[model samples]
Target: MSTNFTYFADMSRKGIFSGHIQAMVYDRSKPFNSLPLLPPTGIEEDVDILKKLVSSSRALASVDGKVQRLPNPSMLVNTISLQEAKASSEIENIFTTEDELYKAVSDTIQEGQASPSTKEVLRYRESLWEGYRRIQEKGTIDLDGIVAIFSKIKNTSGGIRPPHSLTVIRRGQSEFRAGEIIYTPPRGPGIVEHLMANLLDYLSDKVDPNTDPLLKMCISHYQFEAIHPFPDGNGRSGRILNLLYLVNKGLLNHPILYLSKYIIVHKDDYYHHLAGVTQAGKWKPWILYILDAVEQTAKLTNQLITNILEQMESTLEHGRETIKWYTKEINELLFSQPYLKPKLVGDRLKIASRTTLNKYFSELQAAGMLAQIKDGREVFYINRDLVKILEG
Candidate 1:
């Protein structure tokens, strides 16, 4: 049976309204503890599109398995993680070049000298790893844990915004009207607390499980965003939750899916779909939007894994045939950080001579495996193919 999800209105405190003396109110408080009536969990949604989505995600799972089988998964992991960080941050208008980001996080470089955009991206990646580790250790994402995730990303002590803060989601800044109030989130400490408690319940699977985990994730995500728990960092934190939720449900073995890349690509439609549910009680379109995101991203991810494996093998095979100093360890080391320096690889391989280091990398450059990059007085080798794959 189809059900209507109407937005509930909440009265605002006196003087809380936006400009022009209109009483400010929040009308998007659709709770998540209950009342998101999904279609029957099974055969009802088994349309051709759903079937294709299942096939696409299943194919992603298969490729994810193959990526793990590679001689070194760290190579792909580092590349994908940074790319995800870059793409996710870009959605927020924080921009940085790939070279700058890679150089910013480089162990040899000084962190203080990195551009603001680069530093933000590095923080996003670091926070993601922290969240992944937290989930792996605790096996649960509690309120405190979510706060900590935001803290790490924002580089501050992050917690839900209090009622006194007066955070309103607005568009365009105009002195006359304080911009248009797109939506005013729930206020009051007690109300926010209750909603968060319900969120924890949903995340823990303590609620009903009739809906598929994927669909539930979509609902949970909408709830979190609507809750708008934090004054800032809600978007990024919510995204981190997306990946963690997938992991919690065992949809992914590792946090390797670059789902943000897909979202950033469809940025406008992404927000529009979310807004549809908020304003018009449209659920099917939003759910299908996320399903397609996962499906398309999965297909893209699977192809990338294949490309990485093939490139790594090709590089290793070339080394085996031509280079006298070729070793699997050396090959993996290069892929591990597509930007290679002589001192770095030399330290790893115990080669004390500059000539030997240059020879090894130069041969690969000649083979089109690497391109010699000059950074001021120092020369570095860029794994051109890996860079392209990761950047794209």
Candidate 2:
């Protein structure tokens, strides 16, 4: 590593430089073949970094405890994962509204009703759940598993970017320097494979056994983005890997943390810190950024969970008092997802008659516990409070 205070000071003022600069030989236009391997030296020794890690770890543990204590943890997983999917996709410029996404999940939207963006967002959610499942089963994700996740996210059978693929990350189209190259990921005959292998090893603790899991996650994320292993969906795949890594390490029992929300709020800082690591060897800022994301996201998620639990309890109490047919099962079903179709409700509650199910919905709506919304010939009963909480 080299120190160029004058040069980095300018970049730092522009939010591009952080800790220190790497070798000057690094070029943005050419392939980053010299990209360093995992477990960067002295990162674990920084007192400031260690302090952030401790606070982040504590906040993350709090979220894990809150999630486990829920009677229907899968409900939180379902809602939060979809939220992550939407936020992560939005980062890539994929746009979709929360209503459309929830409608798609509720199946109230007919075939071809979901826009391409919404479908893509749903695929992200699917990929996230699948990755979490694979982590639980295998206790670790290998290169093949990584490819599988990317494949599911992209809805293609394609694997890693071959040696010939010319993938270059660039600025957004709306930016002043639109289409300008920001960084060229590693490319060569075996460079990607070798780097990916090292990343997998590091993730499995085979390379950096003493490194903290959270710190290792931040390092692996940068390396994965730098490697740019897949031809597409690398960013989304890397985000999924973040949650899965936390779960695999037992820091989280379920992949429910909405880290993407934090990234969305700090989009500029996120990219700058990533660039900090790639352009310069500034691990401290990137590490601190991710630590802040984890800690803040954990607190936000914890608050979201608290709001949801409170809403559920209040809804249950009100429904019990207002509706004659109201039961705990109905409240649980309604809160399982923000949107619900009549048939889904009937099927879940084992109500065999359409007329009876209709009455239940009507009574619930009349009691102000559910709001009715129409989409074409279909009807959806929405828990508006739940939707508001989720949208937040």
- Which candidate wins on lDDT? 2
Q: Evaluate all candidate structures by whole-model CA lDDT and list the values in order.
A: 0.71, 0.86
How does candidate 1 fare on TM-score?
0.83
Model 2, 1-392: lDDT tens digits are 13334533454475432223354456788987767766677788899999999999999999999998888899878988888999999989998988888888887345257888998999998898888888878988888788889999998999989988888988888997999999898886766886787788889988879899999998888888888999889999999999999889999999998999889889999999988887768888998999999999999999999999999899999998998778887788888888888888878878899999888888988889889988777777888999899887
Task: Tell me the spans in candidate 2 whose CA falls farther than 4 Å from its real position.
Answer: 1-21, 108-112
Worst 10 residues of 2 by lDDT: 15-24
Q: Estimate each model's TM-score.
A: 0.83, 0.93
CA RMSD of each candidate after superposition: 7.1, 6.5
lDDT of 1 by residue, 1-392 (tens): 01111112222222221112121222633222222222213332647546655765686577568766877675667678888888888877789988877666655464467888888888888877888888889998888888888888888975878767777776645334656666666665455665677678767877655555776677678778877888877887888888888777777766777888889889888888877766655666777787788778877888888887788788889877887767788778878865777777888888899898777778877767678867676566788878877766
Clashes of 2: 0
